[model samples]
Target: MALNKKPVKGMKDILPEEMQIRDYAISVIKETYGKFGFTSIETPCAESIANLTSKQGGDNEKLLFKVLKRGEKLDVAGAASEEDVVDFGLRYDLTVPLVRYYSAHSAQLPSPFKALQIGNVWRADNPQRGRYRQFMQCDIDILGEASNLAEIELILATTTTLGKLGFKGFEIRINDRRLLKAMAAYSGFPEEAYDSVFITLDKMDKIGPEGVKTELLENGFGESCVERYLELYQGLEKAEDGVAYLADMLKGVAETSVTDNLREIIDSVQATKTAGFEMVFDATLVRGMSYYTGTIFEIAIPEFGGSCGGGGRYDAMVGKFTGKEVPACGFSIGFERIIMLLLENGFQIPDRPKKIACLVEKGVEGQALCDVIAKAQAMRETGSQVLVVRMNKNKKFQKEQLMAEGYAEFEEFYKEGLRN
Candidate 1:
């Protein structure tokens, strides 16, 4: 009798049929990222326990999934304190681990190195609609630069990448945390405002304009600050589109260098000129991350209830590793979520690259079997997903049965054909 086995909660499987869309999204990311001089790099899935926690600061610490330590004493300890013994863990996000890698390798890299990575990340969060315990991130980062151009470059790369992924009617919302902090200070909420200021601002969209005002007042924000913040969010919604919004926000709510950064980003985006792109300057935007130092951004698609991906300037992540402050900024697309959205919306995926698929007959002629296997492998050499027939087969009815197995596209050569 077979024992029952299934995936643990919060973790999921990637089935074969689903890989078609996943592969399509990844290809778009890599192609668009590469066009921007971004190169691929991968980090180990397991990272030291201390590294992940320290960078995210306090806000995102709750999502980490710990790994138990192993030893002869493991049987005793692992069973009892399952959470405590886990000294290492699957990464929560690609950015933290990448900072460690870049810090370790920056000497061999050029200024403002751009990295494009496609990999899985795990988070231990309550499962809900469009949320998961584990997912993949397609991230792009520019390290060793403090200039705002990195932000602009990130927008171009992300927008083009999403465009290739079959997304339209989406806007990239840019905000400066410094601007948010300033608004809070200006409102006379000062120290107390930090408590729930961003938490309220983050919900400006979902809570409606009046709801945010009520929530902010309840959070102890003065009438002045609440009014300003509300006005900012309201102006953003009316700004025509992303580019138009950026223009309006630059004139309306943005203060300090945040305004300059927004304008420069607009100019860089226009001069660089990627097709089918829009950029919005959203003043009310306050992201979830605690590490963002300068500019911050979120990717919003109407199809998805919330953002598809987001990231911002740390300018200090590398310092956590090397103890030397370094300017770094990056953005990551929630690979699993976007793929889910694409699937849900019934977006047309590209055709499988290689048309040939083989289904072999078991106990068939040895020479013919080897010939079929070799041809399949040869196609894979030029970049095809080749799946070999492994299970036992009844040759008598196999060919007729294989029509539904995706082998109709292949040029069929049977054992009997070779025997002739």
Candidate 2:
């Protein structure tokens, strides 16, 4: 049998149409994020399995596309464990690699480095709509900024970028991991079990409040703790100011500064935002990363009916690499999902340069071809996209295909003369 020509499962081949949108989106993301002082950076796609499995990546650690040792290092029969055989894995997300990058380069980098990273990540995940085993990730992060200003700037820059891409009225569902723990504490949950409780809580959107409560009880949590914890959600549903309610209710059980910092982030972003989006206080937002030590958030687009992107404060991540805690926060836009939404909505890249097709007849001589090529080059220098191709037998069908590719004006070079 012949070898398979298709891409492996859960991966895709991007066509020219989709590639155009992807390129345009990257440009918009870079330009918008650059205005907020985030300099571009890069990291390798593969990372050491040790760092990838450090338990900071939540479920992503399980989905890593592990890379095995090569050459003489590949002693599979002699290896006692998976780690002994596999030494590296493709990064599932940008954050881990970014933290490692910062740790390695901090001596030469600025204090509170704002980094913008865009690249492909791989996960051995089952593919679905707007999700794939391999996809692009665009992230902006601030390291060494210990205050809520980092959060505010990240939120503003992300929303502004979305707005520039023509998204509006979407929701930025914001929450604090600290607040999630505090709520659990107030409900009498043991401090050590907060992670388990929040894991169940993160399913509220899928299973609803009743589902979360049932899961908590079935998982051996106390009924009183479960009831008290869920009752807060019910109260929040009725309250106009959910954050204030949490602040007042969890005051003695949680730190005053946690609520204060979150409040400031919300107020500052709302006050100065240039985008058409909502800053929502979602008590149910439990971002799945185990490393997020403080605020966490996700993007919810009504049109997509799912999260478009998200990130949070992973202050402890850098410490894992550098041996000293550094304050850090980040926001990642779901690059692939955003492109899917834009394509679904027929988004047209604004201010595109004029596109022209130069079709030369097969019978045209060398001098004529050279003249056509020279003219196309001149047009390109003057800020136009010009495509020169040999005219097909069926000129009409050729022009039709070119039209679908966004070629508007067409010039036909005949053996004797030119036709427009």
Candidate 3:
């Protein structure tokens, strides 16, 4: 009989070779996040339907992997759920559940709490290049205080960490959703135009100016207003030169509410960051989340096919449930995507050996082999992979067999590992 074993279409098992790179990326993220006063926390993989669906923007809820209630008991809770659910659905992303966790436990947390979360997130969306149904997301968020300073710090922290991890040619694109709203007002678009405008803006980089224009027109955007927005990306502006661009866009806008909020954003970016990431006042960046009441960003490396990761402010998410608004902003990096970039581009990360194959002659010396096994067991206790090599015995024949198997590292006969 043939063996039947393979991962499902959108999932993959991490092989030993790939695991070295994966662990290194995770360690780099954890250590980097720790220095910024962000404490690590984890929530359940399954979250209640209410928490998952409640106020999550975009098509995120559509991707949720719902867990069926046991033994037809779902009928008992039908139409009107007495309790939210015990057999909850798999979490779509860490943000929603993290917000739920914070809102429920806010009294126990310090004012202006910062958290670092790293975990697997599932999306039922069709897998494509660099996108998997199950993937890892690493995020750091600050909650309970509205501070533009937090945005600056988060950008610096992420760039610094990625730099330390040996990435190059990457830039952090920063934009204030407040400023997008200001532009929408300046252009005389309405409140209902909010979601569509941002989503269209996000596709600007991907679809080119003309394509975006066509899309907007197809989506019912007036031609004259779209022309005014397309001017932001045409010029060659570096990170340092973006302030002038922002001032030009916001100039003479009577909406002081948006302008004043934007001044805070400008000051936050201008106050001198030691990290080498460019911040552009991109009026074009509308992070797809509806509740994003402030700054938004996406990090991209030029060599990669897509933005490495992105996230932004979502202040109204928690307020819908708890009735008290919580100020919050965060970003998530595509963990597996980063690994692919490193592996493909020769980015080196710390590596550890995952397997050790030990070999022994069949009938030569059981007692002598016992000593070798003892040493191997000691290494195994410390989490080293060790496999005792068993073979048909005749000392001379077995010796040749071991060498042919590339087990010459065993010439030390038990002193060193297989690779040695």
Query: What is the C-alpha local distance difference test score of each model?
Result: 0.75, 0.93, 0.73
> lDDT per residue, candidate 3, 1-420, as tens digits?
987597887888986547877888888888988998888999989887667766674687778787767665666645365343335678888888888889889999997898999998888989887888898888998897686667766776777778778876667777777677666666656768867876777787788788877887888878877766555455425435554555566677634555455566656654665555665556576766666777788887787866788888888877876998988989888777788888887654445444455666455356677787897898789876676776444656866765543344442353234232
The superposed Cα distance between candidate 1 and the true structure at residue 174, in angstroms, equals 1.0
lDDT of 2 at 294: 93
Which parts of model 3 have CA positions greater than 4 angstroms off? 1-4, 76-87, 227-241, 251-276, 351-358, 363-367, 373-420
For each candidate in turn, the TM-score is: 0.82, 0.98, 0.81
Candidate closer to the true structure by lDDT (higher is better), 2 or 3: 2
* Model 2 C-alpha lDDT per residue in residues 1-420, reported as the tens digit of each score: 999999998899999999999999999999999999999999999999999999999999989999999999999999999978999999999999999999999999999899999999999998999999999999999999998989999999999999999999999989998898889989999988888998899899999988999999998999999999988999999999998898898878879898888889989999999999999999999988899999999999998899999999998988888789999999999999999999999989899999999998888878878999999999999999999999998999999999999999998889885555
By summed lDDT, which 10 consecutive residues of candidate 2 come out lowest?
Answer: 411-420
lDDT of 1 by residue, 22-125 (tens): 88778888888999899999999978888877747446567777776776544643465544566788888888889888988989988879998888888888
Model 1 per-residue lDDT at 205: 72
**What does each candidate score in C-alpha RMSD?**
4.3, 1.3, 5.2
Off by over 4 Å in 1: 55-58, 72-86, 222-255, 347-351, 357-363, 367-405, 410-420
True lDDT of residue 172, candidate 2: 93
